[model samples]
Target: MALATVGGCGSAEPSQQTETDDSAVVLPIIPAGTKADSILVDKSDRTLILYKGDEEIARYGNIRFGDTPEGHKRFEGDERTPEGRYTINGRNPGSRYHLSLRISYPNAADRAYAEARGKSPGGDIFIHGQPNGREGAPLASDWTDGCIALSNAEIQQIWETVPDGTEIYILP
Candidate 1:
């Protein structure tokens, strides 16, 4: 499938650097006070990667998604994580989850597609941590309504490193 890309939101584009030896994964050297400008979510791999300019800053694996986790989300309650480009539009410290970074899903194309079918394109998608009152290892299965999930510590790191308006590309 063709990868979907959107115009930059006035931020630097992200690029991945690989070692000459294909088997080795070279992590980028990020200076102190640096922040991620973009994020990439690979649904098939269940991973979320953070990038700064052309360098990968961090990569979180074992990410979880909605119960029905494949494919682009089309309507409310589909339980499918959306596939495409979006932005981290907001954050919620008081969210029921440990911490949350909002994703700007249901873009123009999403709305049009759902409207044509007379269904509501769901909103309120986010990348968040475990439930606020829960304490332990992360859940073992796909459980969100349609949001991406990470561990509390992982989300805390992401919350501090990623700013609002960071571009995110969710892929299948």
Candidate 2:
């Protein structure tokens, strides 16, 4: 067996345990009953905004789109973000791209649109953290399978603030 230590000169023993006291840390807790009413994603500005009714809860810029990065996502492997109204239907804290909040893509309209063209309205869209474990990675490009990309830190804040079933509007 072998052990790899981070930032170690030679010896691999850790100086401190990897745990924190919630009570001791002055955490920025979300307000009680402060539920997010909607999420707005502006493709032009590359921004994602979280709102509680009329008031803005949190907003993040420098967002990334898909690899193709233009217009609505049509069929499977389009590599384009979708533009429509949807709900945050599912959550995955343990995901391949860090934490993820699943978007309910391929709604009735999308399915119909694709089906009419004899295509598959690809599913499994989400607002997720950056690649490489979603911990802390600088975003460099629009490269995804039609999923919105955010920094791991931004996703963490969103995970805490936005609850499932909240509405999301992705704009073109």
Candidate 3:
């Protein structure tokens, strides 16, 4: 039986590491017992913001996405990060990337839309860190197959703050 690799950032190719003179990336200090209830990703701005109720808790800039990085993903290999509301359903501590939070893509509407056209609605979207064993600065361009990418340090912060079942809204 042929096994299929589902939703990961898809490429084994190493993204070009960046060299910057900017100061080290600093994560915002969340107060003890604080947890994020929601996440928002703005594709046009390339940012991911975490929220606790109506208050903003953390924001990650320079977030990377699929090569196309323009619109909602409808089918497999579209190279587009999905837009709309999704839940963070799982966590991957042993991911190929540093750490990952799974996004529930292909909700019923997504599946119907794709199946209506006789195409598969790909699943397995995630918000994850830089690929494992990668060092230096994060990649300088959009690189993931469809999932969102963050720096290793940034992901560590997110991993701690975002629990499973958090609602995420990805906006184009």
lDDT of each: 0.77, 0.72, 0.82
Tens-digit lDDT string for candidate 2 (1-172)? 1122221011123232111222221223467667688999999999888898888877788888888887998888788888999999877654555467878887999999999999988887888765543322455788777889876666767877888899999999
Q: Model 1, 69-139: lDDT tens per residue?
A: 98899998788889999999887665666666778988999999999999998887889777655645677
Runs in model 1 with CA error above 4 Å? 1-31
- Answer with 2 or 3, whichever has the higher lDDT: 3
Ranking by lDDT: 3, 1, 2
- Residues 67-119, model 3: lDDT tens digits: 88997999988988999999998877766676678888979999999999999
TM-score of each: 0.82, 0.79, 0.88
Which regions of candidate 3 deviate over 4 angstroms?
1-5, 10-23
TM-score of 2: 0.79
RMSD of each: 11.3, 10.1, 4.8
- lDDT at position 33, candidate 2: 61
Tell me the lDDT of model 2 at 32: 65
Model 2 gets an lDDT of 0.72
